[model samples]
Target: MSRAFRIQVSEGVQRIVHVEDGVQGTIDVLPILAPERMAELLATELEKRGYTRTDQDGELVLVKVGEGNVTVEVNVRTGTVTVSIAEEVQVNVSTTASGTAENIEDARKQAEDRAMRQLEAAVVPLQEAARREATARLEAELAEVRPELDAVVNAATAEALVEKARELGDIESIEGSAEDGNLTIKVRV
Candidate 1:
């Protein structure tokens, strides 16, 4: 192998910020699913909040973060929700990167320090309110999922029970009716 005498110098800053917001509440979830409608409503809310629609898989919603092309994930769960963004934005810079060696020694040294500071500055400010923004947006959107689940279940179950009473073999005659979710069953054996 031929003798190699060379130097390489590179400078840059990589800024990555991970922002997540989580909140818990007793939001009611209905067992029945109209997922397509649900997703449409949810995606609408996310779009309103500055998230660009990218792709969706099953129950997961993915959006592109505006400033840095970061990936944001929204998870909709029963009684809970979480939004998160994890991405890296690069602000690194290269100095005289030529000849390498003694020539870049001074510039590279200075740039390295500046790059570090810039990275820190760019990401720290986002941390202060990113989570809050996510939380607030999610909270507002979560209202759509709220429904009178308990009332619906109670009414349906009651009506079903009345219908079942008519099937009892011991009953000679039966009358069962439901109105306004109120069930009336009369059986004569």
Candidate 2:
């Protein structure tokens, strides 16, 4: 048997960019925070501190990343992040049937296999939790740098706006959109 888990990090570039720009720009540019890059950075950071990156089917599992022993699981397509600590689980099996000793032994093995499967299932959620923790930490750090990013973007936009105003006579209108922390400003002619 097999099991799967995911923790989604929905495209947050929209919100983050908006927050940075302070609602004074009209370009809909997506910030570059690709899921793969994020995963790789996280894994590398963890590995630097003696953490292991494991390949589990299609997920990137971080066995440890940073000051603590934490596991993170990432879903490539869906961009889900899960964080949790992994713990070993024991499986027990018992059989009561009047048959060949070999048959009973086989039954015990089957039971043990079932128990092992159960253990894996239980461990998956812990990985999901770890992913969440890693993601949270990343977001918090990103937030601090947002204003600086916004200033750079805004300065360039201002330069472009000056050039446009010179060419287009005068700005007729301005509009802003703020969603999920993303900011966009549009100049109307």
Candidate 3:
């Protein structure tokens, strides 16, 4: 006589997922002086705007950490700015299945396979949710940071322009607002 056996198996999957997004752009500061001098001026301006100078990878970079864990890094020498945010998500899923077979081992294998397949199916939705959450966070941070970043770059450019005008000739007067995005300098060479 052959006897059938019932077997049950459970499987679990756990993952720590990292989601990150960022924007990188160049600050359009005209090369009004030597590269080193321009970088120095930019660094000074950045410091005035609450960015702290720090060494990154043996290179000087200006860094600011803002609300929502957003980080802004400015490579003074290269006029490059990177704004980024990262989030960590934990995903845990488990499944259980039962099978009956003539042999206990065969039943256990069938149940295990079923459990594994259920876990595999759950993984995609979990990953998709994590990604959506990350993207939403990035969008919110960008909304808050965009105007401030624009103002900082504009002010830096205005300062550089004023310095360049001085080097070129005598500046009669300066006018307009950097915040307004209009700056005029009257220099007589």
Candidate 4:
């Protein structure tokens, strides 16, 4: 006679998940000068604002590491800026299952498989939640950084305008504040 057996199994999974998010935006530099000169002017302006300049694949990139592990990268040639952040989260999931079969080994195997499947199913939701949390954090950081980035772009644009005006002729006088988003230059050709 074959006897039935019951088996129970429990499984736990722990993972350190890395979550990241980013946003991309463009800055209008006005094209007041040649592209190369515009890029050079923007790079200089960003360097003055605490961004480090680096060349990536022959493209000029300015990088700044900010609070909360946020990294900002500006591509001078393309006027594209990317702000990104990363966070690590710990996920722990456990599941228990029971199975019955004629053979003890078969019962145990069935229980183990069920428990593992349950654990796997639980992991997806946890990872999705972590991703959402990371996105929320990124949004918050972006809100704080947006205005400052806009100001930097404005300053760079003002500087470019001044350089263009000089190239046009002779600048007799300059007026207004770049910070106020208004600049006036009088040039004599």
In what order do the candidates fall by lDDT, top score first? 4, 3, 1, 2
Better of 2 and 4 by lDDT: 4
Question: How close to the true structure is residue 28 of candidate 3, measured as C-alpha lDDT?
Answer: 71
Segments of candidate 2 deviating more than 4 angstroms = 1-102, 161-189
Question: Ten-residue segment with the worst summed lDDT in candidate 4?
Answer: 144-153
Q: Candidate 3, which segments miss by more than 4 Å at Cα?
A: 10-13, 168-172, 186-189
Weakest 10 consecutive residues of candidate 2 by summed lDDT: 12-21
TM-score of each: 0.36, 0.32, 0.79, 0.88
The best candidate by lDDT is 4
Ranking by TM-score: 4, 3, 1, 2
lDDT of 2 by residue, 10-113 (tens): 11111111001011112222223444543444444435445466677857654433223334343322334444333332323222222122355554555555
Please list the C-alpha lDDT of all candidates, in the order they appear: 0.44, 0.40, 0.83, 0.87
- Cα lDDT tens digits, model 3, 91-159, are 999988998899999999989988888988887789788877777776787786667767776777788
Error of 3 at 36 (Å): 2.2
- Positional deviation of 19 in candidate 2, in angstroms? 26
Q: Native-vs-model 1 lDDT?
A: 0.44
Q: C-alpha displacement of 79 in model 2, angstroms?
A: 20
Q: What is the lDDT of residue 86 in candidate 4?
A: 79
